[model samples]
Target: MAGAAIKKKIGLFFGSFNPVHVGHMIIANYMATQTDLDQVWLVVSPQNPLKPKNSLARDYDRLHLVRLAIGENPNLRASDIEFSLPKPSYTIDTLTYLKEKYPDHQFVLIMGGDNLASLHRWKNYELLLRDHEIFVYRRPGYDIPQHFEEHPQVHFFEAPLMHISASYIRQAIQEGHSVQYLVTEPVFQYLESSALYKS
Candidate 1:
């Protein structure tokens, strides 16, 4: 007789994570603890189709920062899956690959309300909604659309509002402002020592 199967529910949070900050950490923590997800994986994109490549930091550096911010969290993980995929990574492709690779686990897409507002603009977004479940976190200004709000596959979760953004942190670093509380200690130290985001 075969052994009983072990399956897990994982939330995939896809981002460039130019420099992982406290806001990102808080959201991931909330998702892992407050929701049904067994684990949350931060999928670091090598190149986001919606973002310009020049505006991003090195892929490995961004991945490292994500690792630092998620330190010692048993339920949180950092994945560089998109790094090995083709450039200008698309969410649909990543999701498909993840589903194929981990057939035993159920994969859910995690995104901000802001992203949800523009989700229709993404490549093969219809297929995404048709095949997978998505967890949308409310952003400060953006609200999920009426139709999507009622979608069976979409679940909205309320997280503590955070105005912090990676671009803001980078700008502060460039202007020589203290980022003491903005990022995790390890990430802060790495940014400072590596002189990252200082133009």
Candidate 2:
């Protein structure tokens, strides 16, 4: 089975992209281009259906923002896999579903340093560490244990990350400030034309 079929290397980037921004695009593009990955999927974290409605359809809204942020980049893609999965999604569970769904694709987990630090606390984390390759991006001020770094499945990249946070962008939008450069042109245009986070 070694050379029976060439598997597609897909990087799974999970996030709650309340509003996808330029930073996410940059990192995703970098990972796709700089690494051996054929495509980098920005997987949107689904909103809990059981929770009370906040009047904002965050599940679909975030997916659209991610799509807008990615634009026509061939190497980058926006995925709403979690939106259809069980609520309170887990990395291992998502990985399992994706693996079963796409048998020819090898899914790699892409995460920030902050997530890496707390990965052990996640549900079925041992399975995640054992079954999938973990790609950690550069993040300031977040630290990880040396033992995990020594793990063969865990790899780190020096991709530069913007200090800007989604909360900051939301706050800026609420204040009626221009976030033209903070996000992609399409996202910025959409936000400008629509009342997204100004509540």
Candidate 3:
């Protein structure tokens, strides 16, 4: 008898990745190296429904930054799947498209504890938890609630946490301050030459 095929596990780490900081790279690398996932796709979301759109950098610029940050790592990838999707891309819709587009791969939702806490507010939030593997990383001051226990598919990891935020980086750059180590060298150089975040 032939053994059943093992589906390739891909963790979808969705984010704005405003400048693709070192903190984002750290989490993505940790997840890919430590987890059962074969690859981790850093999905650069064009627009998040819950987040304010006014602050986001250009879609292609963010995507390019993510790609530059990832470089040639086989386990990590940059994705612009949401660019062609509708405005304010919904998680469920993106998952559905991926499922249909690539049937041989298993997709997992990579998120922070803060995102898990606000799951109730997402579009089709129940269906998202019901059908997909949700991998959550811990964040400072945000803890996953005990009341919502769905153990089997929802997994948690204590990946290294950093207090750095994209907003803080943006604010710093806007104020003519240095953001040298926050982002990768390529990203830093790119930011140095362009006025992407400067108001």
Candidate 4:
């Protein structure tokens, strides 16, 4: 008899994850449970073209933080695929590579309303919209743009939005404030142990 076929719908959540925080995990968990996605992969970007290079932590450190945040969640994973790819990683390229590598799995792009607003600025933005499905979670103040409000490939979810941000956490650490509930305990411990974000 033939082995069971490989068929899993994976949601790709791409971010720098300067230090993976609870907000990131909450959004991913919601997507995994509320949507048809079978799993969620937090694809850590080595360098986002739009972001400043100096604002990010080391690639491996960010990857490690993502892994630590995911912990034993069977349906959640951390990927360093972008690290091996070209610098200033682009979403379209990452999606294409993932599709080619995991032929049996359906990959959906997971992003926030803020990203949707700036989607047009992305490389091959039109191709990305036409080629893959995107799950956009609502952010605090950003609204879904009119152009993408009715897009066939775009789906919006009411995942809980947290005001917390990686930069905020880093600032707190640098200012000697408590970041207790902002990030996962393991990640917090790792950051402290490594003396990260401390200038």
Candidate 5:
């Protein structure tokens, strides 16, 4: 059998992105420019197996918000591949599908230190680390394990500390608070006009 074709390194940033915001974009942009990654794809998950289903907005709405957030950044992209897949999206399943569909593209996982600390609970977590590199950005206070330092595929990046989270944004919006400047103007408008995040 022939080996898969090689293409530019693409960073896979998986998230609920219930409503895409500036913090999300900043991490992506920083990764693209600071790391070896050539492009960053915001993989908007329909549902996360570990998170509450009720936490998410409609899959399409989230995807649309991601699209709006990226705007014309040629290196940034939004993908809704998880929506068409089975429910309770798992990182392993999504990564497997992406590898098959975009064989030419080399993929690296982008996550925060908090996620890394809990990655052992993920389905097929071992295979994920073995098959692809991980770019971990720092979170508020989560400590990365010492073993990760021994792994060749694990990389740590010190991105600006925004302390921003999707849940906080959602809470603020639901309470009729302004989300201005935290997200791009278009995404903020979409969230309000579409009445997303309302309890």
Candidate 6:
């Protein structure tokens, strides 16, 4: 009875949404409604260490795109916590800061199965496994690696697969091809109006 009263559960999804798209929303919505998490926050990273800087869109622009994409979803939110942090954003450090800032919230990391395959390369990934739970969504051609099961905190969700990528979106925009349905209409408008990722 002592533990039955706690209701705050948070899902933390970290990514550089160079441009927020429908695929990202599908996974986030799936995790929020289908899982134990009460809310899902899209933590828009200012930078990602594993990806090349040249390919990344402006941090604030990406954040605004995320906000536009998630509009009016009470359970979904856009966060710019990484914008104030150091470059080459590290998830472990962000997680640590988040935990301290919101002590009552139980946070779970939401990621794609693709990340599970390369999680070991992340900085302090071992600590990530130790300190937080993971909710993994599937990706094409990327199976959840065996070692993830070695950690008791990891959980897999057979999330709906949406074959979309920011890279693809960027390429489409640069080619003057329509990416109309790949992302939300608002997002598409923002990208077109702002002339983002068109290079």
lDDT of 6 by residue, 1-199 (tens): 3665584899999888878889899989999999999999999987789888888888888888999999899999999988887888899999888888888888899998889899999999999998889998877798777777666899988889787889988998999999898999999887778778877
lDDT of 5 by residue, 1-199 (tens): 9986658899999998877888889998999888999999999988888888877788898899999999998989999888888888898898899889987889999999999999999999999999999999988778889999678999999987576778889999989999898899989887778767887
Q: How well is each residue in 33-132 modelled by candidate 1, as lDDT tens digits? A: 9999999999988888888889899889999999989889999999999988877798889888888899999899999999999999999999999988
Clashes of 4: 0
Better of 3 and 5 by lDDT: 3
Indicate whether candidate 4 or candidate 5 has the larger lDDT: 4
Model 4 poorest 10 in a row by lDDT: 138-147
Report, for every candidate in turn, its global Cα lDDT versus the true structure.
0.90, 0.85, 0.92, 0.90, 0.89, 0.88
The per-prediction CA RMSD against the true structure, in angstroms, equals: 1.6, 2.5, 1.2, 2.1, 2.3, 1.8
> Tens-digit lDDT track for model 4 on 59-124?
998898999898999989999999889877999998888889989988889999999899889999
Instruction: Tell me the RMSD of model 6 versus the true structure.
Output: 1.8
Pairs that clash in candidate 3: none
Q: Look at candidate 4 and give me any clashing residue pairs.
A: none
Candidate 6: where is the Cα deviation over 4 Å?
A: 1-7
Candidate 4 TM-score versus the reference: 0.94
Clashes of 2: 0
What's the TM for model 3?
0.96
Judged by whole-model lDDT over C-alpha atoms, candidate 1 comes out at 0.90
